[model samples]
Target: MNDDVTCISCPLGCRIHVEKKGDRITVVGHMCKKGEEYAIQEVKDPRRVLTTTVKIEGGRQCLLPVRSEKQIPKDLVKKCVIELSKIGIKAPIKCGDLVYKNILETGANIIATRDVESVEKK
Candidate 1:
């Protein structure tokens, strides 16, 4: 089963035609090196990085920057985002701090992409 997909690998956004017969696959309409690999992997397995905010204490509001340590399953991104929304982080966070451990069992943790300092109250 093959499907056509537009390549977002670059600004060109080339329209790709993919055909699969038995175990073989063919593709066309790619204009860059990134798109060729993208088409091959798209026909194989598609993955995307997850980025979202998590609850933080002592910040301007109550949220901190968070992201997956590595790209998890693309299908799992929504589930992960839902779960991440439930996470609450205490303030004075460090960059690269482990925010959530073994999230989705991807052997990856949601980490603090930036430090959120405690807001001094007047």
Candidate 2:
């Protein structure tokens, strides 16, 4: 199988061509080592940092912005979001607070991106 991948490892976006045959792989068109590494890993296993909003109770906003501390498997992004959607957290939440830990056993923690102050009680 032959595939083209755009390298996102640096400012220069090199279009890398990768060819996989049985157990052998060949990469071309990369300008740097980072690009080459990116192409290889992208083809083998892709990962991405997840960022989304979740339900927040008694806060300045109706939703709290959250993100994974590290990149998780790209395939599990949707599942992570679906799980988060079912959770509602109470404020006040500080930035960098741990919202969820080891999400889906991907070794990535969901953390609050911004502070959410608690609303005054009536």
Candidate 3:
């Protein structure tokens, strides 16, 4: 099988051609080592950092921004989003605070991206 991939490891978006025969794989059109590695890994397993909003209770804002601390498997993104939707956090959250730990056992932490102050009651 032959596949074409664009390298995102650096500013140079190298269009790499990957050819897989049995267990052997050949990559071409990459200028750097990182590009070559990226092509191979992308073909095998792709990952991405998730950024989304979570429900916040008693905050100035209705929702709080959150993101995965590290990249997780692409396939689990939808499930993670669903899990986040079911959760509700309190107000007064600071940036970098842990929202969810070891999410789906992928070893990725969902952290708050911004500060949310608590709402004062009259």
Candidate 4:
């Protein structure tokens, strides 16, 4: 069987044809250097930047924008987001604060990308 795909390296998406025959592979259709490399790497392993919000304690909203420092497995993004949604961080959270560490053991922990001041009750 052959799995032909495309490389979205730049504005010009190059159509790539990846033929895999039980560990043997062949790639074609590359416009640039990155296109070919991207196609091959994607076929072996695909990744995407993880961006989502976790719960917050003293913020007006229950969540804040947080992202993994680096791109992780695309499949894990959804699972990470769902897990973050259930978390609640305390107030006075500074940017770069560790909201949750060792999340999913992806070596990428959920952090506070924005600063939140603790609301003082009147």
> What are the TM-scores, per candidate, against the unseen true structure?
0.80, 0.82, 0.82, 0.69
Q: Between candidates 2 and 3, name the one with more favorable TM-score.
A: 3
Judging by TM-score, tell me the better candidate of 2 and 4: 2
| lDDT for residue 84 in candidate 4, whole number 0-100 | 82
**Candidate 4: misplaced stretches above 4 Å?**
8-12, 19-27, 31-34, 120-122
Judged by lDDT relative to the true structure, which candidate is superior, 3 or 4? 3
Model 3 C-alpha lDDT per residue in residues 53-86, reported as the tens digit of each score: 9999989999999999998998999999999999
**Candidate order by TM-score, highest to lowest?**
3, 2, 1, 4
Candidate 1: segments with Cα more than 4 A from true spot: 120-122
Alpha carbon lDDT of each predicted model? 0.82, 0.93, 0.93, 0.77
Which residue pairs clash in candidate 3? none
lDDT of model 1 at position 88: 82
* Best candidate, TM-score: 3
For model 1, what is the error of residue 32's alpha carbon versus the real structure, in angstroms, after optimal superposition?
Answer: 2.0
After TM-score superposition, the amount by which residue 103's alpha carbon in candidate 1 deviates from its true location, in angstroms, is 1.7
Instruction: Quote the positional error of residue 19 for candidate 2 in Å.
Output: 4.0
Better of 1 and 4 by TM-score: 1
Per-residue lDDT of model 4, residues 1-122, tens digit only: 56666776788888898778888777888877788778777878887668887767776556777878766787998998898888777777788888778779888877778877777731
Tens-digit per-residue lDDT, 8-57, candidate 2: 88878899999999999999999988888889989999888899999999
What number of clashing residue pairs does each candidate have, in the order they appear? 0, 0, 0, 0
Prediction 1 TM-score vs. true = 0.80
Error of 2 at 77 (Å): 0.8
